[model samples]
Target: MRITRRKRLLIGLVAGFFLVFVTGLRAFDPGFVTSIRLLGFDGYQRLWPRTEADYPVRIVDIDEKSLAKFGQWPWRRDRLGELTTALAGMGAASIAYDVIFAEPDRLSPHRYLPELTREGATGTELPDALAKSLPDTDEVFARAIAGAPVVLGYAVLSGDGGSTPALKAGTAFAGSDPTDALPAFASTLTSLPVLEAAAAGNGAVSLSARDTEGIVRRVPMLFTDGTRVYPSLAMEALRVAQGASGFIVRTSDASGEIGVGPPKVTDIKVGDFPFPTTERGEFWVYFNADRADRYVSAADVLDPQKRAAIAPLIEGRIILVGTSSVGLYDIRATPLGELVPGVSIHAQALEQILSGDFLSRPDWADGAEIIATFLLGLAVIGLVLAFGAIWAAAIGGILAAILYGGAIHFFRNQGLLLDPIYPTAVNLFVVYAAATALLYFLTEREKRFVRAAFGQYLAPEMVKRLEASPDGLKLGGEMRDMTILFMDVRGFTPISEQLTPTDLVAFLNALLSPLSEEIQQREGTIDKYIGDSIMAFWNAPMDVADHARLACRTALDMVRTVDRLNEADAFRFRARGLATQTVRIGVGLNTGEACVGNMGSDRRFNYSVIGDAVNVAARIESSCKAVGADCVVSEDTARAAADFAFLEAGAIPLKGKTTPIKLFALVGDADHAATEAFKTLADAHARLVDAIDANDVARALAGLASCRALAPAALHDFYDRFAERIDAMAVAAPA
Candidate 1:
């Protein structure tokens, strides 16, 4: 649970790498990430779409029905002339052709006249008058366009070098020339000179950009061929309809950031409508599904009877002329998930401009996304480290919801396209997954260490308790009131010397195995093994309410267990014709404040206890050997284990202590403590301890002798040791 600095740095580096990868993807505008971004954009449109299409823009669709009624496409320039005349008569604002007139009409009289002249000619001078009398179909269409409010469309090619459309709108650059920044075209295919010249304005119909998936999501409002910038069909239509003489292009200023230089066309002003566009002068079209309300069949417009019924629809609207006929191959994909006539894309852009509802992903939006990615990634990592995976996942989900919901809300309510998909996917899922996985591995390793270190020393339940809360096992010390136990086999060197190394190991395992179980069963953690000695403690790495009582009870149980082991060993040794040496252990229990936790250098550490209390416990165990008792505990521990019986051992100044402290010989559990004999012995032993602490050598001797007479076999050695101490004090006294 303790995240090292190195691990944190690694986590941060991984998160940073993701941010950089996404940012680089955005900078390069790679097709895959762009595809996902566009998909998200499409999702936003679908969830809460532009439900109203109220702009005065209509598409004169040359649909399947129209093709059926009016014959196939290239419906004769004269018929197109008639259609244009009809719309002009109906008071249409502007008529823009999404169809390009790149070449002279094939059905023109010029073509037939030349063919007929050749058919009838011998050399020259054949059907000259007949050729002169035939009216040219292109002239007819050109004349009609000249007479009507029409904007001619053209296609811009990448390198197919063709004629460029004339820039009808007077363009004035507000900042540096934006031709370099605008979408570039090597050449163009415009209407025939006669037709383009006669039309009120000319604009490019070719889309400057397409999504990676080949969906047309935006149309450039302007494009540049060399140094000349030209407007799109939709922009030109709106400009001529509004009677604007020119377009005012606002480019970025040179005074901005040093490396950025001047930006591309930022806004294209046409009369009173100031349209916001991408740096490339493109507009994100908030498309509506191909709507019946926005269409008027071209055939219907050409039909005299039907023309009257549809006149209102085309009247006073900017009519875009293009085909929706599938055979014509003019249909294009849109965010609305429908294929609409390409002309409808132009119509929708013009509609959005006129309505002043735009979808914009500004230059600053990229910066915002980068920042969000970094911050959200950090938050996720922090949450996972501090609170673990479950809480981190909950918080991550909430963050993702907020981002997605906010993006949708902005797109629907404010027409601001703020991308949430990249940040949510990268930060919430990708970064979260990386950080969580790293933490999981690190924490699991820590858990394994805890289990391996404590598994053999603690009970299964205790190991589970430590595993469940490994965070408490910080690699530093904290002072806590603890009960430390130190147990050692009494006089084990002689027993070890009598046996072979294999026998010694077997003997040690047999003696330490049950002792470890006794300590672990009483909720004690074994610190380590020093030859025959096993040091343990309670109330750390986790909490135990009656730690002192548990330590005392473990000591009593250990004594009883060793007694049984000694009996078993004695019988086994006799049967094998070996020297019979009993296995006896001395246990010391001390209750006081000590520092407990992982200790040692960074490379190697041990979860153990230190300070005076721990040292005194070891000294108490050593004292047990001199007293010939199995267990000795400090007065503090004796008081803590109120349910157990303790016979007071005369005070002795512990090693490194200035004052003598009282000690107790742990006798039995609560049941034994209630016996009349234990109560009587406890009273007599307490009196003897008081006499010794007062330095009343004569009185201490008398009290010790009386206790020796009344004591059980277990306390006889305890009494005899103190009597010898009193006699020594009496001998050393000044005369």
Candidate 2:
């Protein structure tokens, strides 16, 4: 189950490919992703909105109330002239008309009298003096515009009539030419020549070209007619109010970095404020839903009595003259989903720029989103592979929450329009789901492989444990503290030689069945069997905290079970006319650092342990026959098993080893270990080993004799080995 370098590379490439795919999609910005982004923008506006209209911009709406009071649609041009003159007299900074005066007013005397003559066919032509005395309605409106701060609005049409409006603001560029980057118009719908000539400035009133979902999200600050660029209605109004001379188009090349592509217009500087825009010079309008505080009815402004009521609202404020009447067809959609007068869009843009609280999507936003998607996706992939699907999902969910929360914070506090939903969906759901599914499939495959490979050798419980955490079945060993156990029947070879092959097989199985159960019950993994002996270890495949103690306990339980089996075998052997010899087993347990994992070739391998410690456990088992003990453990095991009593056995140099390791014979569990008699026997055993090491034969014999009398029957074999050691030392000593 090891993930090779090539496999890891492939995984990274897959994730990288996903990142590249999404990033390219973002670059191209197809309709679906754009729609998602717009949804996020709408959510931000809804969650944290500017409920109050605090900017110094007012809308002179020709609303339903005004239409009711002033008759019907397209009220007399003299009345519109009177409204304009009233706003000018009230100290308004500037009055911009969102309405276009395209044709001559039919109410004017110049046109009405001619219509009267055509209908009657008997009336003589009016006198020249009388005709000259009657005032023209269009001339009255133009005179009103000439005497006040007024910016007339014109439309950029896509049809014929290619007449361009006069550009009042001087145009200049700071860097590369910005004419190519500005929004282009094929034709223009302008006011009458008298109105256009009388106005202080004229600008295009058309919305930007990129309003998705029919929402007026952006408004162009300027537009081009092939030769010259002119400001929009909102921009022209602000320029006239501040008495600014011209528009300063700041291009990307102004920053002194030679850009890869054609330079884009980054900002439009007017007066003291520089408004940030998209490459096409469009401003993102932060809208408030038809605030009542921002509106003053045109009827109220025109009436002398109500004029005083609205004079305070218009003093030194930029006023937009537009209609919200449904019949006028000037209604537009905003971020809040409210239909407001189209003039409100221009008013909001100017207000946002003047208040310095505009929403901006920086040029580097795409790169940031792409990088974030890649890193987040990679992290989720690694988590799912290293842990599991559930854990990876939990972590990914947390990150998603943080990402969205951060986006909201930036939008509310910093006025940034970052798209959090698109990036989050790509990383958390798209990439994470794919990686989790792949990991889950590979993990199940690994579990099935583990079960098939170790099913026959390991106990059922052991196989189940391996299946639960198949990541532990990887090839190559991990160095860990492990307790190794080696068990063998005492006279297995002689006993096997006496039986037929079939009988030997049956006998071995009968003996090994209970032994394997004892080992598995204590959470020991059986490595392999050598003839009648079993080699197993604890703390592999899964961690066992008290591994050394568990191995010791399993060894003792195994010895007791073998003895019971031997009693049954003795009775059967006597009836069969065979020798009445019982079976016995010796076990050796050692605890130390060892490398435990699968070992061998690529085709076949065994989950086993190897190191000097494993060899020492085998050598310990071999020495068990000389000591006449059922089980022996190294000092490492005795220290870890606090509940058991140990009789200290003398150290012996194991075969093929330079250093000798000390050994202890495990006696019983805590209850027996706490007995006064066991304590006395343990102290005596320790003294006997110390005496023998110092070559004091008299003290060694006395100590061994005392232990033999005080110890349980299990200590008899222990004392016999010490007695032989003392005798050998006495014979080898010099006089």
Candidate 3:
């Protein structure tokens, strides 16, 4: 139970070794752990989502309403041209189409009306201007696009591409080339040549994230096909709207404080606005809930009446034109748990760019979390070894709450992503493992202590008891009748702290010398000494006359011996300039059948007794501190030693037990048993227990008061604590 400095350090090192192993496993970053970290980030968004603001950004949704009014998929380029013109007329800063125009419009007059002209004899000849205008619909669309700051979107195929996207903006790197950081795509499906040439800029609409579930959490700000790097749809929109010529991509520095990392993109700037990004050149999106105010139907932009009414939402806003129709299958999931149009992702990204309020994880984030996990693990292990499992767990729970809550707060207030789940999880596992390891170590040390204490055969019977069984060298032992006694000094910690090592050793020897003499005289064998406590058993090696009675006599004598030392000032504490203090102890005795002989690890063995009865003795001794008694014995021991002066304590529940055990305090020898005062006090104690069993709080309290008055001064604290327990029960009971 007590470890020296060297042993404690060894324990810490063992736990630290375990910590390093677990941290290595985490460094592997398995999929499940990644999912857990992502899930945690998602929860933060759900709890404190971005607040909606009227930014200069909007999504021109080709929703079900628009589709119903405009017929079906792939409306003629003339209609798209008309929609483009309407947005431009409404003062849209930049209109980026999330749709594609890969082929020429089939409805152009030369392709269809030429047949009508040949077959329909009854139809009049087309007017010259109308015929010319019908054949040049693509030209009309191209002209509309050329008039506005329009950005054309293209599909980025994952496999080999037929053709790379035409670059619209020049890119310049600030440090070592970080081309690898930009997501690379195989090919692209660009707009029609004429439409693409007319647009102010062309960008890839494709978005990729850390998750495969298509949850748009982080979207790349830039992309590349082996030869050239291109801006994403959102970035292109910002550049075109701001009339910026080229972009600057900054990687980590090669000198000074920001140096020392592998070359990765640190920030990207478009015009005057710059923002941080993940090493992969991706921007983290802090999303708001689906807002009706953020979307304007394509039909509304086309409808003269609706367009007049909704012009405010379109004016001066960078609009992303994309289909929100479910049948189109362009819907994607968001961290806010909503199925949104693909264009909504771009819109939110653009919004954050404009507001300069981006969610970012620093390069040092991983290192910070690893250190945090290790430090917390160390603290938890120390607490478990020094205190106990319950106290450590309580403190761990509080620390974990603070960490998780702080993570949420930082995300909400500072747009910072800090993970708490992994560290807390690591700490939880560390605490459990440390406790189990320490328990095993304690058992092994006790075995070694037992071996050293009884290296020589103290008695011939002890040698016979240890060697008589064939399995003596083995740990499995034989059962025999025994009487177990456990004794502990109550205030040993504080008392030991006050004395020097030499003085403390001398004091302990002086205190234990007389107690050991009484036990030996009574034919009790001392099993071991754990710190200031003693464990001894009777009838283990050989049977003695009334072994239970002898054990009880030894316990009573030990109590009186401590009392004598305190009264005589035996240790001379006052001479050291310290206030006079009495040394207190608690003793427990139990008689039952227990396993006795050489038992422990096969490599090392010890002569000892272990069983439920032995465990009960230890529990009873511990409860003496709670019951305010010097010596307590179980019912079996009381029955074995019927002539001893014993007063009933109670049927109290011990740790890890289903039923309570009956216990009594051993007062004196047979002469004390014959006294009338002992009998009266015993009667009162019995009535108090009966009142308590009957659930009569008032009667129990009154009986307890009477018993306390009749009992000796030593039991007053027990009665006082007993009354408090009864009151607590009454308050907790139903009215």
Candidate 4:
């Protein structure tokens, strides 16, 4: 049993739909992608299209290369002293290190030790000498620290050890806790004198990005260590950068049974002005890790040579000195790269937060993504049903590309966060696969029905169209502003006479399928087949805006499609010992008022057209062989075309016509080469027209010949008809 093309396409479409539905239902992750998009926002803030509406503090990266040049970890105190002094001299606004000088420097343990390690070593001369060298370094570093404004980092332990109640008075609470609150993420300590004496401001650098899947996002703004709430690394930088008097954490009402805290905003008062934030302790980081920006390694500061190039960024900048080396375990996994600099990530976040251009996924985003995907899928499927796989895919791909690219572009340039990947991919995959599959099944079913009913006597496209517009198969008629197209296969009669009936049938089927398909695909109704001639009409059952353009496109495709068929039939033609000349078709199309619908009795109805427009189209097709033209149309048709390019083919009076109709030859101009060639012909034709208007028959003939020569066989057929008209005018000219 042969299956019809319609059924095949329908089956394919259904399968494709199922695939899309499953993937859309199961694979989408709005929260995850949203978080990644936020990170991308940070990148945009720091990188391309920089903004001044961002955090002022700059990152001083200790990159992998710097690590290789300088020795391993923990540089001596004297080196740190030099760095502090350099920053102080440059008049930097403030210098805050993300790293803590938690333990006494190994080089000067006894000198700066918090009395714990110095008790037994005081009597030893070896310890004394080491202490003497190291303690002096500390005093010099301490003086540098003491001279310039500096905010040293320390973490508050949330669960156990943190700033005591005594230290809690001046610090701001991150608002009242919602139910039981969690502890500060990290904690740190230093000797009492070290913490008090050298510090201009004491704050915690302990903060963390919560991860649903161990991917850091949403950095905490304020971390609580039981009684007191402390600032984050970025928060400390802001305070130092702005010289703000203090920080304030604001919270909104809680929701639900758990009473989760509403989004918090951190407000900092700079002088008399307030700087607000999205989260309690956290703001976006603006990353500006330019190669030329301020950067220095702890090892480089230790070395005299490399430190010069790296020292300038530290000058008054809230310099964040942290490890960027892969070996040092300071590298972080960010949306951009796995080996991203940890400090740079913070810097980028800070920059983004301060700009108020955070990568945001509001609660309403998930539904939007799903809706977009669903609609896009539906669109792709509908187009496939209307067109075919190749064209549908092309259109689908273009749409997807535009959407994704536009989203990324908007995010980077306009500071908007939107997900382009999931919607585009999901839509393309689901819609295309589902639609194509259904179409394949429909087409298969159509092929089966056609093979069973027509027994390979009718073309595939005709069968497909029959199935598509079965309503038109009823015995009736309807008036429409239609463009009727007629195609006549050149040399088909002679070729058919030469071949056996079986071979001729095969050849005819091969040539007719694509031609008919082109017409149907362009939304033209296949009126009927008259031996080697095909009659089709556009804007019949369907209203087509550019009916003339569709007619032209259909005609051109029919001519081109024969070549594709000839390639496949080349072997058969060769085996028959024939010349294997390619089968070519001549087409004539006209747009005008026409009567179109099913004709004949109910038992055997035929969908067809009948009107002057239809007659003119048929006459044009008949004239193709005589004029040596492949395709031609009346001026009425050309005027209706908004796009197709054409060459003038002089006026010709039909047998029963009172007024001679002006005609034009259809020329291919879809690509640059064809368009250029056609342009040259058009220019020459214009000159010819000018000569004819002036009754300069000689010049007109000359211009016509030039056009003919320039385009060769391409316009030869059209030129011959013009030449005849020019000759007649020359003979009848007044002497």
Candidate that would win on lDDT? 2
Query: What is the per-residue lDDT of model 1 for residues 1-735, given as tens digits with 9 covering 90 to 100?
Result: 455666667766776676566556665666776787889999888876676856799999898888888787787898899999999999999999998888888877767658755786545544667677888889999999999999998888877678767778899877778887888888888889989889999988888466557688889888887688888898899988988898888887634422266666677798889978888888888877777888888888998988778888888899999888888888788887888888888988888888888888867777887677666777787777666678988988898898888887878777888878887886766777877777777667767987887787678898887777675565578889999999988767777777889878877887788889999889899899998899999998788899999999899999999888767763255556666556678999899999988788888878889999999998899889676578899999998998898877657577888887778888888889999888887787778878877878878877887788778887777777887778888888777
- What is model 1's C-alpha RMSD? 5.0
> Cα RMSD to native, each candidate?
5.0, 7.1, 21.6, 17.7
Q: Against the unseen true structure, what C-alpha lDDT does each candidate score?
A: 0.82, 0.83, 0.81, 0.61
Model 3 per-residue lDDT tens digits across residues 1-735: 344455567667777787776677567778887777788888788888887888999898888998899899878777888999999999898999988888887777655575577687538766667666565677778999999999998888877754677789999888877777678888888888899899999988878746755678987888877667788888889899888987888888633328565678888999989988887789898898879988888988999988888888888889899988999999999988999988898999988889888889878777777777777787777776676567778888788888888888878788889889888887687645665577566646645543454434234344444333212332356787789999999888889889889988998888877887777777677887787888889875555679999999999889889889978888887556655377889999989999987767778766788999899999999989777678899999999999988877778788877998988878878888888998888788888888887878988888988987898887787777678778976997689
Residue 495 of model 4, lDDT score: 84
User: On lDDT, who's better, 3 or 4?
Assistant: 3
lDDT ranking from best candidate downward: 2, 1, 3, 4
- TM-score of candidate 3 versus the correct structure, residues matched by position: 0.62
Write model 2 residue lDDT over 1-735, tens digit each, in one string: 344344455555665677667767777888888888887898778776664657789999998898889888787788889998999999899999998888889888777776676687637777767777888999999999999999999999877775878878998888888788888888899999999999998988999777788888999998988788889999999988888888899888887745558888888888888988888899888876677888898889978998887888999999999988888887898888889889889988888888887788878777777777766777777766555568878888888788888888888888888887877887766777666566556667767888877775566777787777665555688998999999988877778778899888887888888999999888888899899999999988777789988898898899889778767763255557666377788999999999988898998888889998899999999888776688888988888887797777767778988988788787776677999988887787778888888999899889878987887676677678878888998999897
Question: What is the number of backbone collisions in each predicted candidate, taken in the order shown?
Answer: 0, 0, 0, 65
Cα lDDT over the full model 2:
0.83
- Superior by TM-score: candidate 1 or candidate 3: 1
- TM-score preference between candidates 2 and 4, better one: 2
State residue 616's C-alpha deviation in candidate 4, in Å: 37
What's the C-alpha lDDT at position 48 in model 3? 82
Worst 10 residues of 2 by lDDT: 1-10
